[model samples]
Target: MTTINDIAKLANVSRSTVSRHLNKNGYVSQEAQERIDKVIQETSYLPSQSAKSLRTKKTGVIGVILPKISTETASRVVDGINQMLQENDYQMLLTQTSLDKDKEIAFIKLLQSRNVDGVILLGTNTDEALVNEIQKADVPVVVLGQNMPSTTSISYPDYNATVEMITYMLENGYRDISFIGVPEDDPAVGILRKKAYIDTLKKYNLPILEERMAFGDFSIESGYDAMQTIMMHSSQPNAVFVVTDNMAVGAMQYLKENHYSIPKDIGMATTGVSRLSKYIEPVLTTIDFQNEDAGIAITRLLMEKLNGYNKTKKLTHTYRRLSGNSL
Candidate 1:
């Protein structure tokens, strides 16, 4: 309930003097500064965010738009962003679009209306209209985990990385591989991984069997269902490369319940290896994408843009692989 006026009256100074001292924008006599500090400590008066933003045009807030941040990978990305923003004294406003294009656009517009200093978008596919809108607003928008033209972006080498892994598997004498993946129609999640699977098969002169490729919803349940269907086939794959660790775990559970030995009976590998992977029977042989680094880098770029220091058209992020037991 204490206002600047109350502090000014108690200190016998103008409200402007108190405001300057609080913002560190101007100096005050030692006695006046001491009195103001004492009054502030006693009253615990905090400035209104709206009023401060109105005066400085810097809200000290950043917006993060993610697609299904509940997942382990997405959560790690959020943690990285939070750590960086906390260090920089900026708060985060998070929204999940569930990978819906319309919802994502709406969220971006809403954040813009709120005058957020910057925005970091996760798992976004390029859209020219969206890029144009972001550019016209003169707001710094950093796209994370996907490449986009005409905007700053940080992306992992997902397609090529998968291709490399699959190539390695084939060269090492693994055949009859089943790829459990999300639907390719979903550009942000499935297209890249599916493409890698198909391309690698073609490069190695392997028969691309329609029955061998199964689509899932990137969930453990979906993975279980897909694996069940694959098992029903007359010929089973010798190895399975699941696109996500969650799905891989589900597949492994199904295999275990059905008494299908792991690695001994069939080989398995997945994209991410979280804590659960180690405890799981065969310990997933997966690639560590370093999602936390991606998150930190994106936040840093957003902060730079917020501070008016970044003037680049685009930025890209890369990834590394971590080998484990299942492969």
Candidate 2:
């Protein structure tokens, strides 16, 4: 275990000088810095992370709290965050809250206790307490996927975007439309998409049928179940809009298994245009949410916050729509 004392003795400088040089908090002369650098290289001395964190109040680690990490979209966002963090020599500490309000609040406190430089909350559940906690802590907290009051966030237009897709479907002469989405309790749930679906139908004076709506967890299995439920209805919808690609894929699988022809039998559309969507037979019609770009934007914003830029009052990020084959 090589310590700063060993390097200092070898470099013929005081330990304080070595500490200042390694931490980059205090400056030393060029000659002394070079000597310390040479000794550090020769001795293979690595400074203690705890000591560094104490000196700079920066752990060189970012906390990423996601609502439901098992989802494909969340996984892709994590990938993008990793790519950027690796390039910047930063590390990510991931925490999954499973959309539990109590768990999310506890996670925030835990992140703060761990002394993370900042935190990126992937999504918000129904609790507003976390926003106050973030503000009181005076730490940089950036919300992704969902908006928060009195905090900075990167948001997607789930409501308007879904309406746009549904409008397109209606215009295409698809009358009997059904929506598959997550439970309304989850903040990041597909309420917006479902709302858009209902709103569009109402604007056109279409009857709102209770059997046309189905709620499930955001999973392929749930999508399959929802689709089955919708199909069991006396008057099945001619077209369906699934809130997520994962569920849409599942619905497609169920349709295929039942020997139903896509587009010919029933049209399909969904949000999120992942790679899996393309290889499917009809090539799902979806709105590309640009998840990767959103991840990059959120990470960049986190960096800006770390660099002392205030974004609490500004809405700095938004989303774009991608029209794909499934629609």
Among all candidates shown, the one with the greatest TM-score: 2
Candidate 1, run of 10 with poorest lDDT: 312-321
- For candidate 1, the per-residue lDDT at 66 reads 87
lDDT of 2 by residue, 73-152 (tens): 88888888888888776899999988676777787789989888888887655355777777776468888877677777
Candidate 1 CA-lDDT value: 0.82
Instruction: Tell me the lDDT of candidate 2.
Output: 0.82
Candidate 1: regions farther than 4 A off? 1-45, 186-188
TM agreement with the true structure for every prediction: 0.86, 0.86
Q: Count the backbone clashes (under 3 Å) in each candidate.
A: 0, 3
Model 1, residue 195: displacement in angstroms? Answer: 2.2
